[model samples]
Target: MAYYKEQFVFDDGKPIPIIIRNYMASDLEGMIELQAKCFPPPFPTDLWWNEKQLQNHVSLFPEGAICVEVEGEIVGSMTGLQVQFDPKNPMHTWEEITDNGYIWNHDPNGNTLYVVDICTSPLYRKLKLGQQMMQAMYQTVVALKLERLVGGGRMPGYHRFADEMTVEQYVQAVVKGDIHDPVVTFLLRCGRMPLALIENYLEDEESHNYALLMEWKNPFHR
Candidate 1:
């Protein structure tokens, strides 16, 4: 996995102990269960029904994707695609490999790295596991030398799959309606500002039918 260090272990050394590692083919069932708990409108492996996507996920960001285990049992996992957007090299960004089933891709600038999806078992919430996974994601994106990123929160308007809500609803959800989700706050506290709302971007009847288009510069650029 270009996004993560293969065989890397994350040990907070707590009571249950956490083991983060590359996912295996046999772990699909476990992955499915975790997804249902993590995401509200969980796809649960039935919608995509593509084993190859998971395979590619493990391969793309070996260290980026993590299967959490406590007492030798797979309790949860987190994985997402890293679409490198090298603004200076448009062709390379377009040449990047992505499973045909995956809808994400790196934009031309290569400054952006989009997180297509992320999940962790509900039981693991409040353990900072989600933040940890996000940190790994930030590191992976920065490692690729990206200068920007784009993503959105979930919504209720669409009530579909991933696109389940309006852009504002998703943002409010992401921030817990507190005006500051750790992710958004962290990014902004470091010096980034959001840009726009991509209106009517999808035609899916079940989709929130819209997405937000936000970007950030190299806040820490020296």
Candidate 2:
């Protein structure tokens, strides 16, 4: 895919220029650095990405792997693969979905666009770069004629209520609008919904390694 550039207007009436483009070998250092800044230490054991893993993902589905740049610095990125999964039985962890970071399970002809990660630099968080990356992934799904977008939505606020309620209870509360989970709330506002609660999706203390199996069907899809 060719580079896609656009300007987004901020609430302050200032325009921020950004480019959404395919991942390149040269972006490895910036991508890794940006991810580190986005997700700090004291997190999961294998929640980070490496050069080899990125190479594998790019080799498998180059179009699904995309990054966002501002003034030539990689600030945000989202990775995904075409996959075939049953919506009723979507039981999976992050490792299993991306094949333990190897991403060899990518199927180009699959019916679903399985997004793995969508992150943005801390410096650019106020710019809504993460949402932009998601929009880029959605455009990819449309371009590929996929049925929908699927992924694990991390609940950034789940850890606060973990001591008082079970994971299921927390998820149900979020779904019913009783609670506001940062990640889940954002996904919901983007027209996506959680199908199930996934456990051990990662090894993070914030969310207790739990995630939501989120899906967003293509409304324009036939």
Candidate 3:
């Protein structure tokens, strides 16, 4: 596939161009190193996707596994799979959906694009690479004729008030504009609707192991 490109101007007025494209066999090492830099401590090592798991993602959904490159170096990645949107069972934990990134649940004929993970290298965070990756996913969703984008967004800021509020209360607060969560806020800005609060979805102490079940409907889906 051809690389998708976008240009962004920083505070210094210099234009930085980024290329989004499908993951390649040669990008395996860069992807692993970038993944390591994306998560902080207390984020469980066991929950992280290994090379084999990433390989599985690529093998299963080549069109959904995307990488971001700047100046010839891999700086961000977004991985997703196609799955049927079952209205009967709307709520699902991260593990149940992605099978911990082994992607055993992928359905090539499905109408929903279930994004499993989106991360940017630490050095590139200021460049808003994560947001760029999401935009790329949006384009992919439109191209694939998907109906929606579904994923669990980490609530890294929730632990600050964990002693005072349950995950539900916290999510409720965020939904009501009583509080702002970095991840949740960003997802909202990206046009995703927060559907539910998932418990023990990830292994981060800071997030209190909570994640927001977020979905963005594809307007182009017909």
Candidate 4:
């Protein structure tokens, strides 16, 4: 597949070129750097992508691994894999679903595209690079004739309200627009609907180890 490009203009009207494309072996280092910048110290540094995991992504499903580049630097990325997803049994940990980020369990014939991870450089947050990367994944869904795009979205804002409400209540408040969660809200805005609540989805203290199981069904899938 060919790389996609767009230009974003800054406040001074200087347009910077951005390229969104499938992941390449050479981009692994930059992707790792981006993970550090996006996740920071409190987040486990070990969870960052390593050369082996990135190599697995590119080799196993290159189309599902995408990155955004600005002037030849990797700024944002999204990785996913085809999985045999059972909507009725949607309770799975991030590691279990993503095979500990190696995607070794990728099922070519599976009907669902499971988004494993997505991140953008801290400095490039204003560029909406995440949304663009997601849009590219949506395109992948249609092209692959998948049923939907699914992901376990971290509820980073939940810890702040954990004492005030149950996780379910917190999710309801966010869905009802009564509260705003940086991660969940962003996923909702990307056209994904809440499927369920997953507890102990990962080691995210900010999210109280909780996540919102979200999905975006492909409208073109018949």
Candidate 5:
């Protein structure tokens, strides 16, 4: 069943139907293609979701594994899992938390929703698909009555300023609007607040192996 649906009318003046729904076994191929298109050359193709991992996502946490579809094609996707979060110790590598993208450690009783990955197709970037996917996740958070939605956002734009400023400074700059980081800025626009800066979160050279811990608290949670 579809979790959410909307129609987007772009410059062409044609309404395009967009659906946010749970992942199905049939979506594996399209998802693999999306990963390649979203993260090209230097992104380590091995990091892409394999058939096994995608299968596990649907089997273990179908509610958390969703995709944005348009005319039967998967244009965007987001994957998440519930985890017992420790605010006191917010430092952890992505692999350690996401189980190297398999999300095999998902805890049904956990209090927080940890976003494993969220990406949009290059062709649909301007359609605000990412934001819509985030909104869908927000709905899931409220429905699940979780404490918050948390994730490590990569600083793909950091490589340019690595020689001039520390990761801390760069994050502050982005928060203050003094600098523009694609990932960090997008998270901020999505209503997420920066929790901390994590080191060795991932092996992305563009991000200098660093990631920004971000969160969006559930307003309805009591």
Candidate 6:
């Protein structure tokens, strides 16, 4: 994997330059657009940016989210939330509300890191910018001395729907769902393991799909 300063380009006339710049609230417009191009149904525009920063989410990154830019345009991004899921600082409010219940209470001394989202434009596939993003993401985790990092990754194939469909189209529709992304592949490439497979999970109405939880251990998290 390359560092933040490394620049790698593929033969497709596209260059992915890695930079540690923050994903400022100001960059939400570009971020949202890139997110749309990257995902079947990207996050809504309202949550893309906050007039004022919000905590308890990826926006908690003090350095802001990390992004990839190609020719001065946002092409990819990676963001994380800093949380310590100890008896003192639990992962969330309730236990049954999440799958974290299965994770041991090792967080008593371990800080939990949530990889909220890692996205990249389809035009830049196989370019390895996602690996760079994961490498940078680990740097952030190490800097914060986090113990566990968790996030749901799309399965290898999921149903994706089009904007509009005909009767026959809806009956035999081919949703452009993608279950793989650079970040998850990057984590696996970096020795992370797939913890479990979640089925029929959806973050929202438009995002009905399954996901996997990928995790990496860092003894250096201290």
Model 1 root mean square deviation, Cα atoms: 7.0
Q: Candidate 6, TM-score vs. the true structure?
A: 0.62
lDDT by candidate, in order shown: 0.50, 0.83, 0.81, 0.90, 0.91, 0.53
lDDT of 3: 0.81
List where candidate 5 sits over 4 angstroms from the true fold: 9-14
Q: Where does model 1 exceed 4 Å of error? A: 1-16, 24-26, 39-45, 60-64, 84-109, 157-193, 201-207, 214-222
In candidate 5 the C-alpha lDDT for residue 110 amounts to 95
Q: Please give, for residues 40-115, the per-residue lDDT of candidate 1 as tens digits.
A: 5644345542566666555554544566665666665655455555434332111133344253452334446655
Model 2 score (lDDT): 0.83
Alpha carbon lDDT at 129, candidate 4: 85
TM-score for each candidate, following the candidate numbering? 0.58, 0.91, 0.89, 0.94, 0.95, 0.62
* lDDT of model 4, residue 111: 95
Report the Cα lDDT for residue 41, model 1: 63
Candidate 4 per-residue C-alpha lDDT over 42-124 given as tens digits, one digit per residue, 9 for 90 to 100: 77898789999999999898889999888888989999999989899999999999999999999999999999999999888
Query: How many Å off is the CA of 127 in candidate 5?
Result: 0.7
Number of clashing residue pairs in every model? 14, 0, 0, 0, 0, 2
Ranking by TM-score: 5, 4, 2, 3, 6, 1
- lDDT: which candidate is best? 5
> Which residue pairs clash in candidate 5?
none
Task: Give me the overall lDDT of model 6.
Answer: 0.53
Q: After superposition, how far is residue 120 of candidate 5 from its true place, in Å?
A: 0.9
Model 6 alpha-carbon drift over 4 Å, by segment: 1-6, 12-18, 40-59, 86-110, 158-187, 203-209
